[model samples]
Target chain A: MNANSKTENRALASTVLELDVNNHAGVMSHVVGMFSRRAYNVEGIVCMPVGYEKNGLKSSGETSSEISRIWLLVNEDARLEQMIKQIEKLEDVLSLRRHGAEHEVFERLEEFFH
Target chain B: MAANSISNQKEMFMTSKRSEILTGAQIVVRLLERQGVRLLSGIPGGAILPIYDALSQSTQIHHVLARHEQGAGFIAQGIARASGEVAVCMASSGPGATNLLTAIADAKLDSIPLVAITGQVPKSMIGTDAFQEVDTYGLTIPITKHNFLVGSAEELLEVIPHAFRLAASGRPGPVLVDIPKDVQNQSIEVSDWPAPGASDPAPAPDAVLISRAAAMINGAARPILYLGGGVVHSGASGSAVALAEKAGLPSVMTLMALGAMPVDHPLSLGMLGMHGARCTNLALDECDLLIAVGARFDDRATGKVAAFCSQAKIIHIDIDPSELDKIKTAHVGIAGDVKAVLGQLVPQVEAILRKPWLARVADLKATHPLRMPGIDDPRMPYGLIRAVADCLDDEATISTDVGQHQMWVAQAYPLRRPRQWLTSGGLGTMGFGLPAAIGAALAEPQRTVVCFTGDGSILMNVQEFATAAEEVANVKVVLMNNASLGLVFQQQTMFYGERIFASKFRGMPDFIKVAEGFGWQTLDLDNAGDPSSALRAALSLPGPVLIHASIDRHEQVLPMVAPGAANKDMIGG
Candidate 1:
């Protein structure tokens, strides 16, 4: 169980960069296609809509004045910083940030119906 | 003047020969009708407007405009599951097709036969990223069992029948047909009709492997039967029960295999999982050998893979070859239809007299009996369910949405026939109960059909209540109204230290008023009286009925094998 702890953390690995597209028109769809076809660097991403009010900003090239946010989780490295730069250029995109490690891999469950 | 007149004649001739002509609306009906599609459920969109216009004029087939495309997909699933026949659904190319994804995925997981036909933008502009021209073929491949793109009018008839067969055959799932606009507008000769029965996938049972499985089961001292959804899909429910009855081995169903055995039967252990009965888990733990039929060891079924029945010699049988030894190792691996294999295994088990094994399994059941906690009161929720089951015959079909009510039905009802229970198994899609039960009722109107759903699940497609009322379908909806998302809140209470985040819905409208609003006679099961009178009254009251039973908020389904715990370690009060 402690094999990884005993071993060194010398191997270079990537982290996920999340984008919150707020169900905005074809932003996330185009983004996913771009990643799959063009970037091919981001791995294991999940995106859904959040509120633009929380971020206190507006998206670019959106036909509607009402702004929306999208949450994306990506797996990368310094590449995350670079991907952020590219995603910012897309219209109808407000702000993108990495949701840091705060999740728990469910260990002990007391419930019967899961 | 003579030259000009000749030139005009030549131009007229060339214009007549320009490509081929097919009316957009006529193309839609011809492709579907020629393939022998008798039933289709969907709301028509602009992209598919022409198709609907054509279908309206044709009285040969029936087209039902579903309240939502999602409901359309589920209804198609119900028809396919009951009849084992392929059902069709039509939707517009873009937003319409996207809405149908959940249902398609549901059909894929449960192995239901469905052919979802979506209209696409014209083929003239192949990939300019044109309007309503989403790559539906590519999007549905991973989710659907199979998919097709019809590029020409000639292949229209060819694709339709092939789609029907491909979806109906072995390990059935949804197939998507993306018909381009240009093809729909072309006229073509149809002298040769493509026969509709060419796509059946029959994975024949291996006779040698069946005998080998028989030998293993015949020799084991203590054997237990584990069943899953494939048993239901493969029509192997009879063989499953026969194997259990012959060997005197206790049978446990996965969530998907609820109807394989009558719940009240002595040999039947209701379900085996986190919410499984204590007796069922104990049976799994104590058995000397485990005979898994048409069941892949899902994580929910096997909480901790390493600790799951480690002492037992496992024998696995499945139609899919890769499933063998994928999750857990098997002592004997047999790939074939479970029914065929079990037909051979029954006689072989008769030869082996494993009295000790039977005694041990019975002992295990005796030691860990799962008695419902609120058994003393007649008004108890479980008692209410038992009353409902008693009123309906064993042959009646039951469909359920995922929740506490779903588990309650599984723990209580006794089933007699095969393909009588349809549900969302692998992907527990909510709002599956009412529409699915409607389809089941339509498939066999004479038999009593009942659907059990929670307030949360029912709200997902509450409009279908009107559909049930509108259509001459007799479906009884038993709404377990705790006025909460019972399953979600139950898990949060047990696991999240009772934080109670986003699962509360207390002060709602009078459920009776709501049901009556939908034109359903509502019955409030307030106390421990016989609900049979209300049920009888509703059965005669024209169409569908809703029985709303109020249950406790904190009630928990027990015998939990915690996430990553062994089957033997299941905890129940």
Candidate 2:
């Protein structure tokens, strides 16, 4: 396919989600469970604890190792809006930002999987 | 010099209020006391013995030992549903935690506030499959509002109070806190105490959206108020009724929202759903504006979502934002407390008589009202509920197990106040009634609590009868002995080409003997010439009494919208 067609195909096939969540042992289970329970498939996931800055300063004290960022790639469907709303309802999910399929986060990691 | 002296004195005072060493179990009990939990229910086991030991030392809190872990969970649900406060229940590891899952899930679906504390295997043996070990936190992740797996005793100080807060705050649900055996035994020094967790104030309704909703209501010639469980949960029934009356909107309630608007109200259409009155559902079919408050469009409530109120423009108000468009998109969706939204929206809307529309509704009501067959005969299902209801005033709390009896009570019983009626609406749990009724009675000792249960439902939680007898709870269990799962039988007979399977029971236990064996006062209405008087006498002298009455096995909950069918396609009434 041509470059523009390839991008269009990808957009039609999937959407990427960026999530900021609490870094805890059960956090990943909770995020995945929400999908698994609904029978919604999550094709790719990349999660890692990131440097969480609070008020533009490095968070200290007990919350030093608090936040983690998660990237999810999944098929776009009618239920996606409802799924996003549900994910936002989770207590551990700090924030969620939706991105189109053209987002580079998942595309860049495709080479490693290949 | 004076400021320096004052600072020195403050430091001295801080040092004097030093941390005292206490085990995690002691901290849990102390925290529950601080949270103003006077009564809790649980069953002690190997893992939870330490907490029970600590509980025994607590003079402020009283623990009711339930016959089963599920009973304990439902008991807590009962207290929460009755009092609108976050109630607590505890259990040990493995099976105990698993058993409590259903009640927790029930609370979650109904949005009742509950804190469930379960004892976990020691942290070291957690993954080793030690005796009575379970992954409680993982298991409860989907069912609970939030859950905590405490790694350390110090975490208990924060987790306990936080669990209560999470359970009570926005769209309340059950929160589980799993404490490992080691954590419960571990000693920790705790000086500072956290404040008791209470419900956080709901966010304010959007003025623009509220105004839009007001405009829609004002402009529509035909409008209907759709009330849900959220109305009862948020204590917004009064405000909802006010909005309905002021706008002259005929109101229909979901099963959970039955008591929100008085059944006797002139503008009330009673309940609208699967087994709702024909007129109520027909009115929704005809409305131009559907104002849904605090209610998600549950499938049972909204039969065939696409077809439900197809002509109406919906203005949905709920505390949970996700629920707004989850099923059906709303014209104006307001994610705020229903009580608060109505408080503001009521005044902004124009007060109109809508005479022609109301007259149309009245004609529908006159033509297709709820048919209570054998309503005056005490031997029949509807009559039994009415007879039971006649014996007690509005102060009496009515609960029901999931079955034909539950629907009969929902259809016929005069539930005139909010929280006056409690049934397993969302979960449709059969075993919920007995234990929940005991809990409600225990919570509010003055009010007489009655549980209308069918034979099939009462058998699911028959063990709780012993707990009720032991506690001497003012619970009246009116057993409708139909010798079968009535609702299941009805569905099979109607939808499955008249083929009935395992719905009927071949052998039935002598329930009166069973109740008497459990130390309960037994009343057999089967032979009573004056059943009403017998019911009154039994209800008056209540300390866990079982009043058994035989119902026809073939009786069905009518006006049922066949599964996945539109509400307009109701079968019978």
Candidate 3:
């Protein structure tokens, strides 16, 4: 995957596109490919399986026991809106949430590193 | 005590009467049979031998052995795209699985439903970087709708059904299942048969949004219905025409939605965006209400995003919710199946007398009609497309490899039925035509299947020529050889100050000799003296025939809206 260009960060605000996708092997690749295919770079990505304790949670009728939440960080632009639409179209992606710069996940990570 | 009871319950479930003793390979074959698959394409190899051994005993399915796994993947895609059902492809570990990647990615981009099954090295040897072991799961992640690396035979049973469901369900795409070699040989009691993949219901459109859209349609002086690929996916072509005719709005067909409405419809603004007709783009710019259906405002479709429809109030209708405000924010967004939403919304929209708007559209058409070079020259790409389209059936499935030839087919082919024009619009995959044409022919044996290809694109999978002949597919190959990557050459000439790079080939193999070598009857258009007589003979051939039409490299696809330029500002008009 190509690293996000530094020039994209020169904007005043960056938005984090948080997606809830089915916990399957290819979900992350599809999401990243959608962005890269359009030349839209994702600066930061954090993806993990939601639950490991309960492997037999099949009574709810869900196919997989785990789900993945991926946060994509990028500077906001007019193209970002369209990118989100394409991302939301992914079959594995269940839901999406948009976070402004005020979202603490990235800020906290910066502080912890310091 | 609790742990003991849990183990006891699990043992009981495993030994139930409904269970049958079967090898892992038998389970795989049985699952595919249950999914209603009748045909498959693949090559046999070491890792997948167990499954093939089991497959030999099954009479329910027929497997067409393709020369390459990539060809097999495309054969499956052809079936899926033609039948609107899940198609299956199989391969072994390592290179066999890797070769299938291109077709899988092609299916993903085109939204064709396919399930690719592959054999993996033993589970224990997976991460040690064992011989013939590749990270199949890791490598396939981005290209598939979903993928599974089954840990056991029991998991295999669970994953197969879901894999079919994911591939065939909402926004259909390719899915993959990689099973280890040992798992295929393992025998187990079938404890239970899992339920078939669940069917997803088309989402109901929000009533309020529909009403708002109807109001916009009723109030607007100038409106245009922009159709996209989703319309074909949803089988909403009838609804698309109904909405347009009822509201009396001009409709601009996107590249993917070419046949959604008849090409001759009075209000039809023939293909819109980059290589779109100047009249269509002008009508789009002037419209006050832009009703976008099943189409994303892709960069190719929207020349300059900011100025695409500056004066228009957008109403985006799509099954995929994210597409609602993805490009141009919809003034009224309907997130539901295009057919269902349009079904309800069409009746609510008041009919209008948009005489002035229609007149403006007509005027644009009269003033700046799409012009083709060498209308009388049969050697030209556009002229060849027209000649072939005339010779084929209206319901014929036409697939094209990516390049200048693809754009010409999109522009000139007289498409009469929805889902009849298949091309790599999203990812623009070269080498897609021959394999896809094979797939299409296999799916609908009665319909004529034609593949329009370029020299550069066809060479990408030129070996598939054998697969076409081997399958005895009724596919005709119209090889338009420019001896160079024509699209790239055009781009370089127009944009990059004409510093020609490696786009041209000095010592290319003679395509006719290669086609004949592949056991296909070859015809050189230049040698025939009369193009029409040669085309007639080629089209009437029994099996796969190649019509090699060589043209000058300088010929370019015209009416190009340059990147970042407004739709109205076009060169080569």
Candidate 4:
């Protein structure tokens, strides 16, 4: 429970979550609810639409005509593989992969300072 | 598929359910329900009678009638914060939407998931100066995450889901959906709900940069982990602690990153900036490198941006690309979540510790030390706050209103992780503490909320006292009452000419009496040297509890570098 943990003995863990889905009606709540029910910590969730529909019924293809993608930064050691599998099984989810659970983040200070 | 036939079909669908005329309000409710809205918090008003009537008939959805439209917006925000869901609130046109502006800005700054539905004048009457017509969309764009104005119900299904997705996705924020009177009365069957499913988010850090960041950290002897709200949102508290522990780094958190690490951690510096901990400011001034995560360099956080951490080699990790290079200069910045980035860098930093830098920082900590009085110290508020910190969980959600009391909490209390401490950091909104606490409590019902507010701050929205009672939220209210507008008095004393303009509040209301009136268990602490007993009592109480404590009137949040001054130009107590 250390300062990162709820108590004095355990230490809080961190993880990275990659969202893989094709459409908007994807069962996002299912994966989120699973995480919530399991007491998982969420850091940041970012998503963007990449692919447009082949039919081209939509105008500029802004609002996810083809595929929707997202990026999640979550608390780690959260049984990431199991979480990914569960997310992949959700209705609109096309795939799930874990890329950097074993890595660290590096950045530039000058790039951030205007 | 044919254009003319499709237009005709759409026009026919807009007629109504039974081919009868419907009021604007009825159309609004149906469109809202079609968008899968379960509950809406708002008040009844003169211009929105039609919508309320429609809401009354819709059994699938629920409406929470608020005493004021402001409270309604706050309640919706509460739901969003707790559930990570887009909560809806509504008001009539004009004053209704205006009342929601404060909460909208609140949600906008804090990035809460919220949707505000408001009424507008009929299409023909618009700009012709119709009654109850206000340019809500125009007033909202600058503040809202996104906004929409619907003239017809044909745009209902198309706009509703789009609003929710925008509010809930990306860096979540508030969205406004205003439907005019004629639009709500119309009806159209939206054939297909847009099925852009919720996609998985990228949790990976830029592995390529991890070595570079670690090298920078290793190269610098004195480094500070400037944790931001993104750490909490990223759920990277563990990684943060690991990296800090491994690197033997001292850490300071922004208001939003208050709870990213446990308060009791040896290297943990509670909060940074304006009302930040003195020790934290000292650490920032001396540190040569800053590891920032999910933490934007907000003006409030940076004081005067130019002089803030001017010399530090900053490694900023964030997800929003636009936030990069926004305020302060960054030597090394990564656009990603703190959790993933920290995950990548933790192992890399293991081999690269600057022993000299660590030793120098230790030397600094020993040389210019932070003083801590016992929980029973004569600085009554300080002692009580410390005791409360001792009693509560490291992960407990803490909220505060804007005032001297807030500054005190930011200084005294220890936050262990992000998202655990919520406050009006950017806006410095006064009435925000209580309502925000209520909202936080509602959002994460399983967790407890401790709200630190000033005597002046609590009164801004005392109506929420009853809200706490009615909602039965697990909330603990600590009212640091100094019998005056404490912060205002302090500011006037310091900034103003000390002529005492409206700073001295007279005929103060007895807050204990007021708390009891709202069905909250009340405790009066003229000098609560040790707040343990009160905290225990407040926690042990079945429902919500309020503790009113008095503090020094002239207490200024110390260790201050006035705006635009170098961080080294600090005013230490």
Which has the greatest DockQ? 2
Off by over 4 Å in 3: A1-114, B1-18
**lDDT tens per residue, model 4, B1-573:** 699999988887765433544454565566567666776688777666667878889998866666667778877876666455678888888999899899898888877778898888776787877777798877776567667777566556556766777776656678888877777766554444444313237546667777789898877777888887667655688899899988878888787777678766877766777656555676787778888887888766777766677678888788765565656556776766666778778887855455675666567567655544444652466776786777777657788888877876776777655566777666677787777777677667777888888878888878878777887868888887777788778767777778678877788887888889988887776645455665666665666898777777866666665666655566664
The sequence of per-residue lDDT tens digits that candidate 3 reaches over residues B1-573 is: 999999999888766645688988999999988888888989888889999999999999988888889889988887887777889999999999999999998888777889999999987888888777888887887788778887778777778898988887767789999999999998998857777665478667899999999999999999999999888888999999989999998998888788889877887888999998888888888889999999989889989999898999999998777767866888888888888899999999987768998888899999988887775567888889888877777878998999999998888888868879878788788888888889889878888899999999999888888888888889899988988999999999999999889999898999999989999998999898889878988898888999999999999998898888888899986
Candidate 4 displacement at residue B72 in angstroms: 2.6
Output the better candidate (3/4) by TM-score.
Answer: 3
| CAPRI category for model 3 | acceptable
Return the lDDT, model 3, position A91.
59
What is the Å distance of residue B450 in model 2 from its true position?
Answer: 0.5
Q: What TM-score against the true fold does each predicted structure earn?
A: 0.78, 0.96, 0.87, 0.74
What DockQ was computed for model 1? Answer: 0.02
Best by TM-score: 2
Q: Is candidate 2 or candidate 4 better by DockQ?
A: 2
- Interface RMSD (Å), each candidate? 16.1, 3.6, 5.1, 15.4
Instruction: Tell me chain A's TM-score in each of the predictions.
Output: 0.50, 0.79, 0.73, 0.60
- Proportion of true contacts reproduced by candidate 2: 0.62
Q: What DockQ does each candidate score versus the true complex, computed on alpha carbons? A: 0.02, 0.49, 0.29, 0.02
Ranking by lDDT: 2, 3, 1, 4
